[model samples]
Target: MNIRPIEINDYSRWFDLWQAYLAFYTVELSDEVTQKVWERLMNEDDKDLYGLVCEDEDHVIGFTHYFFHGTTWFDSSYCYLEDLFVEQSVRARGAGRALINGVKEQAQTHGAAKLYWHTDKQNETAQGLYNKVADLTDFIRYDIALKP
Candidate 1:
């Protein structure tokens, strides 16, 4: 599998994968949200947000989205892996692992101090794969959304 940065012409194909990812989590994202995300990814001036797609011979089979931000605790920007998804049929074929490793490489290249992400507690399948590639941190996430 080839993992690479998403390109201008890849919008539709990338959206298909994006939809699949949302479905996997049973989340509904508005078209506005979708378009905004695409715009952010397409903007070359935005260094914080980054995206990658995993391709086999014919199609894009997986994708990973991550971003960098400043933190009080670290000198280098932390890379938060916001999203990662491989096609259902392609699971266990190393595309997921490749995507993650690719992100790790990018974090290093971008001078990121760390690369980290979280998964739902119920996602045992993903946890199984994640356990192999990364250490399980003791941190628990708490969200307090200020806006509707």
Candidate 2:
């Protein structure tokens, strides 16, 4: 598997993996939102948002989207691995690990103070991978959805 920064030409395959990712979470996002995300990932001037894709045999099989942000507790920025997905057929072949290592390389390159991500509580399969790659924090996440 080859991991590299995402290119504009990788959109179609990336979208397929993106949709599968959402499906895995049983979530749906608007097309406009998706378009905006793509735009941000592709924007060279946008230093915060970024994306990477993993390919096998010249076919994109997985993708990850991440971003860097300032935090009150840290001087340097933190990298958040926002989204990650691999095609169902290619799940356990180290593609996911390769994608994450790609992001870790980027975060280190950017001098990020920390790298973190979240997964649903019941996602044991993903947790298995996360446990291998990162420390499990005891902190709980809370969210408030604001009305648009």
* Residue 146 displacement (Å), model 2: 1.2
- lDDT tens digits, residues 39-94, model 1? 98889985557899999995889889999888888887899999999989989999
Residues 1-148 of candidate 2: C-alpha lDDT, one tens digit per residue: 9999999999998888888888998999999988988899899985568999999999999999999999898789999999999999978999999999999999999999999999988999999999999999989999999988
Regions more than 4 Å wrong, model 1: none
Task: Measure candidate 2: CA RMSD.
Answer: 1.0
Worst 10 residues of 2 by lDDT: 40-49
Best by lDDT: 2
- The C-alpha TM-scores of every prediction are 0.96, 0.96
Least well predicted 10-residue stretch by lDDT in candidate 1: 40-49
| Pairs of residues clashing in candidate 2 | none
